[model samples]
Target: MVSLPEELQAREAAARQRMEELQAEAAELAVRLERARADLSRWEITRETVVQVLAELSAAEAVPEVVARDASDPKDAPAPHGIGVMAVPPWREGLVAGVLPDVYRDIVEIVADAPGPLQAKQIVPRIRLEATTAKIEGTRGKLKRLVERGWLDEDTPGRFTLARHYGDTGRVNSR
Candidate 1:
């Protein structure tokens, strides 16, 4: 065996110390990572619990309904950030597609100029859709969306009446 010099022995000791320090640092990092993982799991459970409780409260239909805000709440309370759910309302796509072929805003204006209810059948021919136009499934679906969104309501199911905002008298008879 080759003999180690005094300097070589000192170097070996220093290398061993460095290896131990590195191993200790690596161990500490692993422990911290595990803790972070546990904390993340805990936070996920917390989110799930909050969602469940909110959904149940909304479903129960209590008087002071605790509805979940579709947007972010303040870091503190009482601040509103966003609007409506990410889930599209069931009627929205069909409504958009139905109105896509027609000049919808113009039609709203046209009907607004009229005093009485506009029947679904009555508004059909008023829509101007060329054969090449993208989507013209029927105006019925779009009309239904307007009703659902509270822009219009049906005096009868087939016949839709406009909201007070339609004509701009600026006064809704609250009765």
Candidate 2:
């Protein structure tokens, strides 16, 4: 029994109230999103700090063994304690070949044998692949994945070295 004008006025008021509620909800969501982003940033920094600390601790612990090994003549130095005649630890002899796919294994082998950090292009020839643009790019992708998997280290941008744990001394076997 309300007049048309009154009904229209009521509808307009409801629409305005709904708009205000939506605006408040949007503001709340924005605030929550910002807080979540800040929390993520804090966690990322904490993770990086922890990783750096652990790397430093590992390096510090390895110093004495490296020094001792280096001081002794190659002929006179005692063989590593638990690693018998195997050049690599029995568990790690097939580590790359066992854990990784064929292409990744090839990449690790190439990096491991290199005298210094290698770029993707330098790895391509050793892998026996044509130096095409796509192949080189794919090699780069595989190298990055190896870095993520802790099998390689990016010594600098576009240059990779085998991760320190896999060094010549077989340090990882001691662990």
lDDT of each: 0.52, 0.66
Candidate 1 — worst ten consecutive residues by lDDT sum?
85-94
Model 2 steric clash pairs: none
lDDT of 1 at 19: 100
Top lDDT: which candidate number? Answer: 2
Cα lDDT of candidate 2 equals 0.66
TM-score of candidate 1 against the unseen true structure: 0.34
Clashing pairs in 1: none
What TM-score, computed on C-alpha atoms, does each candidate reach?
A: 0.34, 0.41
TM-score, candidate number 2: 0.41
Q: After superposition, how far is residue 88 of candidate 2 from its true place, in Å?
A: 21
Residue 2 in model 1: lDDT: 52
Worst 10 residues of 2 by lDDT: 82-91
- lDDT by residue (40-126, candidate 2, tens digit) is 756755775576455545444443432245545776454453222221212234354333444566777777777789999999888
